[model samples]
Target: MTVEITGIILMFLITVLFAYPLGKYFSKVFKGEKTVTDFMNPVERFFFRVCGIHPDESMNWKQFLKALLTINLLWLVYAFFLLIFQDKLPLNPDGNPGQTPDLAFNTAISFLVNCDLQHYSGESGVTYLTQLFVITFLMFVSAATGITALIAVLNGLREKTTQNLGNFWNIFTKTITRILLPLCIVGAILLVFSGTPSSFDGKDSLTTLQGDNVQVSRGPAAGMIAIKHIGTNGGGWFGANSAHPLENPTYLTNMLEMIMQMIIPLALIFTLGFYLNRRKLARVIFGIMTIGMLCLVIPTIISEIGGNPAIEKMGVSQLTGAMEGKEVRFGPAASGYWSTVTTIISTGSVNSMHDSSMPVSGVMQMLGMMINAFYGGCGVGLLNYLIYIIIAVFISGLMVGRTPEFMGHKVEAREVKIATLVTLLSAFLIKGFTALAAYMVAHHPETGWAVQPANWLNNPSYHGFSEMLYEYTSANANNGSGFEGLGDNNIFWNVTTGFVLLLARFIPIIGPVAIIGLMASKKFIPESPGTLRTDSWTFGVVTLAVIIVINALSFFPALALGPIAEYFSLK
Candidate 1:
C-alpha cells in the first residue's frame, strides 16, 4: 500500500519537475527566442518555402482557422483514400486488406482530429505504409495543430492591441521541427533500446512449451509507440495498447510511457505563464487543474487498491487488489493512476482495460473526461480552461457589479456566447448521442441496422448503459479511450462518432481562438480596483467552482443513469 501510494506521488512530482523546464524551453521555441533547436530553423524555412508559405506573414483569427480547417480537410481525404486501398499500397508485408468505407471515414477523421478513437485494431486493420504515412503523420500534425492554435491564442493574449496572430503554416512547421520531432526521436531511441521492436519483419512462428504453434505479430512499433504517447495521440500499434507485452515490455517502459503521455500537456500550462509573462496567473491555473486532477486520482487509487467489495464478500482474498482488467506488470496502483492521468490529459492510452475496473473508478474516468480541461491534451488544455475562465470572469464581474474583464480585455456578449456554446456543445453531443443509443436499444432492438442496440453491448443492465455513455463521452471529449465492452465498429457508430469527433474537436479549438482574437482587437483597459485579479487564489477558487457547477449541471443526470447508478447498485 505504501509503495503504491509512493509511486503515484512520485509520478506527479517527476511530471511537474520535468514540465517546468520544458515549459520555459517551449516558450523560447515558440517566441522565436534563442534555444537548442535553432539549427532546425533552416529545415523549417525549407518546408515553408516549398509550401509557398510566408513565414513573416501573420493572420487574424479567421484566416488562421481557414488554413487550419483546409489543411485538415485535405489530410482527411488523403488518409481516407489510403485506408480504403491499403492492401494495394506499398509496405503491406502482412497483406492486410483495405478498410470498409464507413470505418475508413471514421478512422481518417479520428486520427486527423487527434482523437485517435480507433474502432479497428492496428495489427490486422492497417498496412505498414498507412501506419507510417497516415497514422504517424497525422499524429505529428494534429498535435501540432492544437499547439499552433494555443500559440495563436497566446499571441492574442500577449499583445495589447494586435489583430494579427502569427502565421499558421509557420507555427505548424516550427512546432513539428522544433518541438515534437526532437522529443519523439529521443524517446523512440530509448524505446528501441528498451527492447520494443523497430523492424518490418512479419510474424515469427514459435513452438510453445505444450508444442502448439503460434504466430506472433511484429512491426516497427518502437517509434510509433513513442510518438503515440508523446503526442498524446493514443492509437496503439496493437489493440491492447500498452497492456501488450510487445508494446510495453517492462515496468521501466510503463513509467516512461505514462510520463510521455502527460509531459507536453503539463508543460503547456507553464508555457502559458512563461509566454504571457503571467507567472502568478499560470500558477493559479496550474494549481486549480492539479487540485481537480488529484481530486479524481486519489479516490480512483483508493477504490482500485481496495479491490472489489462483492468479490470480498464471497470469501475471496483480494490482497493484490483489483487485478481483473489490469496488467499484472503495472499492478493496480499504476493502472489506477494511469487511468486518471490518461483521461485527465485526454491522452486515452491505457495500460489496463478500463472496462474491467470498479464502478467508482469508471466514475472517476468519466468525470475526468466530463470536465475535460485539467491539464488536457497538448495546447487544447489551456484553451479549454480559457472557456471556464471567461465564464468565471463574467460571473465574478456580475457579483461585483462591474464590467467583466480578463487580462485587461473586456469580456463582451460575443465572447461569452462563443464560450458558452463551446461548453454546452460537449454536453449536447455526449448526452444526446447516449440518449439516442439508449432509445434505440429499448425501442428498436430489431431494426436490422449494422449496429442493433441489443447487439451493441457485451454487458447488460447498468453496466451496459455505462458502455454506451462511455463511448459518446470518449468521442465528445476527443479522449479516444473506450469502455471496450461496446461493439462500436459498425456503420452507425462509425458515422455518428465521425461527426461528433469533428464538431467536438474543431469547435472547442475555434471558440477559444476566436474569443482571444476578438479580445485582442479590443482596446486595452487599464486595471482598476474594481477589476478582478485573475492571478489571485480567490479567482482560482471561483474558476474551480464554475467548472464544477457547469459540469455537474450538464452531466449529472446522464452520469446518474450510468456510472453513478452502477456505483450505488454495487454498494
Candidate 2:
C-alpha cells in the first residue's frame, strides 16, 4: 500500500515537474516567439504555402470556425471511405477487412473529433494503411484542432479589443510541426527501445511454455501509441489497450504512458498563464483543477486498494487487491490512479478493465468524465472549465450586486446562453441516451433491434445500468474509455454514439471560442473595487463550488441510478 501510494505521488510530481517547462515551451511556440523548434518553421511555412494559406493573414472568430469545420468535414469524408474500403488499400499485411458503414461512421467521427472511441478492435478490424494514414493522422490533427481552438481563445483574451483572433491554419500547422510531431518522434523512439514493436511484419507464431503454439499479432504500434498518449487520444493498437503486454510491456513503459497522457493538458493550463501574462489566474485555475482531480483520485485509490468487502465476506483472500481485470505489473492502486487520470484528462486508454473495478472506484471514474474539466484532453480542459468560470463570474457578480464581467468583457445573455447550452448538452445526451437504452431493454427487449439492450449488457441489474450510463458518459465527455461490459459494436450504439460524439465534441469547443471572441470584441473595462477579480483564491474557491454544485444538480440523479446505486447495492 505504501509503495502504491508512493508511486502515485511520484507520477504526479514528475508530471508537474515536466509540465511546467513544457508549458513555457508551448507558450513560446504558439506565441510565435523563437524557441528550440524554430528550425521547423521552414517546414511549417512550406505546408502553409502549399495549402494556399498566408501565415500573416489572421481571421475573425467566424472565419476561423468555418475553416475548422470545413476541414474536419473533409477529413471525415476521407476517413469514412478509407475505413469502408480498407481491404482495397495498401499496408494490410494481415489482410484485415473493412469496417461496416455504421462502425465506419462512428469511427471516422470519433477520431476526427479527437474522441478516439474504438467500437472496433484495432488488430482484427482496421488495416495498417488506415491505422497510419487515417487513425494516426487524425490523432495528430484532431489534437492540434483542440489546441488551435484554445490558441484562438488566448488570442481573444490577450487583446484588449480586437476583431481578429488569429489564423487557424497557421496555428494548426505550428501545433503539428512545432509541438505534436517532435514529442511523438521522441516518444516513439523511447517506446521502441522499451520493447514495443514498431515493425509492419505480420503475426509471429510462438511456442508457449505449455508447448502450445500461438499467433501473436504485431504491427506499427509505437508511432500510434506515442501520439495516442501525448495527444490524449487513447484508442489502443489492441483491444486490451495499455493492459496488453505488447502495448504496455513493463512498469517503465506504463509510467511513461501515464506521464505522457497528462503532460500536455497540464502544460496547456500553464501555457495560458505564460501567454496571457496572468500567472496568478493560471495558478488559481490550476489549483482548482488539481483539487477536483485529487478529490476523485484519493477516494478511487482507497477503494481499489481496500478491495471489495463482498469478496472478503466470501472468505476469499484479496490481499493483492482486486486483481481480476488488471495487469499484475500495474496493481490495483496504479490501475486505480490511471483510471482517475485517464478519465479526468479525456484520455480513455485503460491499463485495466474499468468494468471489473470496485463500485466506488467506478463512481470516481464516472465522476471524472461527468465533470470533464479537470485537465481535460489537450486544449479542451481549459476550454470546458471556461464555461464554469463564466457561470461563476456571473453568480459572484449577482451576489455582490455588480455587473458581471470577466477579464474586461461583460457576461451578458448571449455568452451565458451559449455557455449554458454547451454545459447542459453533455448531461442531456448522457442521461437521455441511457434512459432510452434502459427503456428499450425493459419495454422492448424482443423487437429484433440491431442492439437489444438485454443482449448488449454483460452484467445484469445495477452494474448493467452502469454500463449503459458509462458508454454515453464516455461519448458525451469525448473520453473514449468504456465499462467494457457493454456490447456496443452494433448499429444502434454506433449511430447513436456517433451523433453524441459530434455534438459533444464540437459544441463545447465552438461555444467557448465564440464566447471568447464575443468578449474580445467588447470594449475593455478598467478594473474597479466593485469588480470581482477572477485570479483571486476566493474566486478559485467559488469556481470550484460552482462546478461541484452544477455537476451535482445536473448529474446526481443519473448517477444515483448507475454507479451510486451500484455502490449502495454492493454495500
Q: Ten consecutive residues with minimal summed lDDT in candidate 2?
A: 445-454
Model 2, 125-217: lDDT tens digits are 998899999999999999999999999999999989998989999998889888899999998899999999999998789899999988998
- State the C-alpha lDDT per candidate: 0.91, 0.92
* All candidates: TM-score: 0.99, 0.99
Return the top candidate by lDDT. Answer: 2
Clashing pairs in 2: none
Question: Across residues 1-571, which tens digit of lDDT does each residue of candidate 1 receive?
Answer: 8987787778778888999999999999888899988888788778888888899798999999999999999999999999999999889888899999999999999998888899999879998899899999999999999999999999999988999999998889888888898889988998899889999997788999999999888899988898898888888998898888889888888888988889999899889999999999999999999999989998898899999888888898898898987888888999999998999888888889999888889989999998999999889888899999999999998999889999999999999999999999999999999889889998998988866767999888888999989988888888899998789999989999999999999999999999999999999998888778999999999999999999999998888888788888878
Model 2 regions more than 4 Å off: none
